[model samples]
Target: MAISDIKRYTHLTDTDVEALSAELAGIRRAVTTSLGAADAAYIRRTIAFQRLLDVAARLTIYSTRSLAGQLLGATALGVAKSVENMEIGHNISHGQWDWMNDPEIHSRNWEWDMAGPSSQWRYSHNYRHHVFSNVVGMDEDLGYGVLRVTRDQPWRPEHLLQPVRNLLLAATFEWGIALHDLHAEQDRTGTTAEKSALSRALIRKLARQVSKDYLLFPALSGRRWRRTLTANLTANLLRNLWAYVVIFCGHFPDGAEKFTRAELENETPAEWYLRQMLGAANFRAGPVMAFLSGNLCYQIEHHLFPDLPSNRYARISTQIQALCEKYNLPYTTGSLARQYLLTLRTIHKLALPDRFLRATSNDAPETASEQKVRAIHETRGTDGRTPRRRHRTRKAKRQVPHGV
Candidate 1:
């Protein structure tokens, strides 16, 4: 079939497009109304209590380990608390608890209590990951010196030892990897230096407090120092390992795209969105796993509509898939276990010689006529009442998915 014919057949009609737009608007309205009706003070209090519970849980695991009797029980409790941090704590901190409340306040609170001062999962995962998406240079999830998960950029010498580095990072400093991108941002943006002197002083004080907890609290618990150290170490290790594995399983699968800025800049919004969907894999959908991962399994939906609450990801994904199909775009997804295996397979592929990593024709752009249709679809309506398009501009003939 001719490219123009394919384009006409695939692109959504204005009515279909309007329907998708209305669905998204309805979701926003529902979330806004729910937030407006919620008791903000109650949410704030509950979030505070949850933070305290998390701290208590962590301390309990440490103390239980020092006492050395219920190893399995302690581990289970620690895992449960970690899951809470991922779900409830993370959600509230994201201001997903009440949409009406100021996100900045909740973000600050989240950074303080739930995520720890060092954790940047909010900015890296929530902000940057969704905004920039599968684009390599922009997506902080790609690689952070420790894990060579995606092959978006040219291979570096350090990447040669990615397997070893990733394992060591998971074992020793998983939290550190989470914060690396945030630290890089602070350094690049000079925000770290712009902090008030008093704030800096307070941060030093907090660092000291955390250090004391790490160094002295375990020994002071009246248990054997060795036992206390071992327990604390094990708890930290397990927590980091779980975090690393879960995140890695989400996007580093085989067949996932690792697009460069050059490649992305040449594509239209529909094409970029399509690439993101195909490049990002979903985990298996289950209540427990969804709850634990904060509903990240619907990653494609999450990427396309980040403002929407996580609870509605699965429901919205169907709509997103329909839109993709209408545009003749790929909508990639898979079970959690399948995606995890794919990640291992991707790693193996990366292990191949650099010469074998060359791009194939499958990665290239579509015909000129296909490009023209994408351009027409992406053009803003001149009705002069709609929001002006603010996303990336297109340059090549490629399939891009529309926002729904």
Candidate 2:
């Protein structure tokens, strides 16, 4: 799995990898040093706007008497909830604004509106998922230990229902994440009492979340409780579905490569940086879409510097793209719709066992290893040399990849 004896599975050599790593580190340093009042003001204003929107939306839902007015209020509330969940809560929990030294904005103190506790999610997400990135067996976030995202992960008989499970996962993404994190917590080395404590924490968080949305708000509506209850349910589901789309587009797209445990052996910062660059994909977005997705359309940049302010990702992406071009690497990105379609393709394709797939585990779009480059070279000639490309006519057939 060695690429020019560097073991990074990339086109770059050891020296080139080191240089790439240094440039990335420099970008981080530049962004870190420039964190100023603008960054602080951005986060503060975001939080205030989200809270105000939430309150206004809730009031509209309660007071609106007409059906059209009810739908409008619920939709607005969903937008507000999505903004809070994606931009404010998600970034704050990443410790992105920790540099400001504001306790309210601190990662550890900011609990999200989801059913899962922020403390529990931090362990599974910031530590396990971010640190491991796309390393097959280690990064549980790779398909969240359920769907088969890569050929490297062998398919099972149960994966036949993956298409169905995919829908369910999207519709209930928040609940899935909550249970996923809880399961991750229990799987660790903990005594029975300790396990019970973790479960209780999740139960308490879930109770509070459920009550606030379903009970308290509806009860306040008196005879109109059913209408309020349905509105809250609709809003929560909308947020869940949107979060699912943003998340899946980032990790499971065709060009976002998956790695094996072998690659993590004696890993260096340079190699780690390379892994993240190759492992995460991005979707094209304007300012509005970026805000709606919590600026996660720059997921490659976020993965590169998880602790950096999320608002800075747009600028960081430009520098990252330049480095990718200089290093002759893939800056994997596309329109949001295209990226999601690619993700869905991978999901449905990998539902079958590997034998049914056309590509090897090492050379597929969603999976690759260092040997991948060598395999391409050897295919062209026995001397490990590549041949010239032959142009095809307009009438020539196109070769479709597996599960196209």
Of the candidates shown, which would achieve the greatest lDDT relative to the real structure?
2
Q: Give the alpha-carbon lDDT of every model.
A: 0.53, 0.81
Which pairs clash (backbone N, Cα, C closer than 3 Å) in model 2? none
Candidate 2, residues 1-404, lDDT tens digits: the string is: 11222333454578888899999989999999999999999999999998898889888988889999889888888888899898988899999999898998999799999989988888889888999888878889988877989776767999998999999999999999999998878878469998899999999999999999999999999998998899999999899999999999989887677777777888899998988887788888999899999999999999999889888899888888777656656677888888899899889998988888887776676665556655654564444321211211110111111111
| Residue 2 lDDT, candidate 2, scale 0-100 | 14
Task: Write candidate 1's Cα lDDT for 1-404 as tens digits.
Answer: 01212223234444544555565566557655664433466445545655575456556654464445535534654465555555555655455654555664354554532223424456555666665665656776665645555443456666667766666766744445434644544544545465343345445645664565457756675665555455555655666676666666666764344555554444544444444555565666687677557677776666665555567677767676665554445455566677766666556555545567663222222112334334544574444432213222121112233221
Give stretches of model 1 more than 4 Å off: 1-25, 34-69, 98-105, 112-126, 145-151, 190-213, 216-220, 224-228, 262-276, 321-329, 356-404
User: How big is the positional error of residue 13 in model 2, measured in Å on the Cα after superposition?
Assistant: 1.6
Question: Model 1 reaches what TM-score against the true structure?
Answer: 0.68
Alpha carbon lDDT at 376, candidate 2: 59
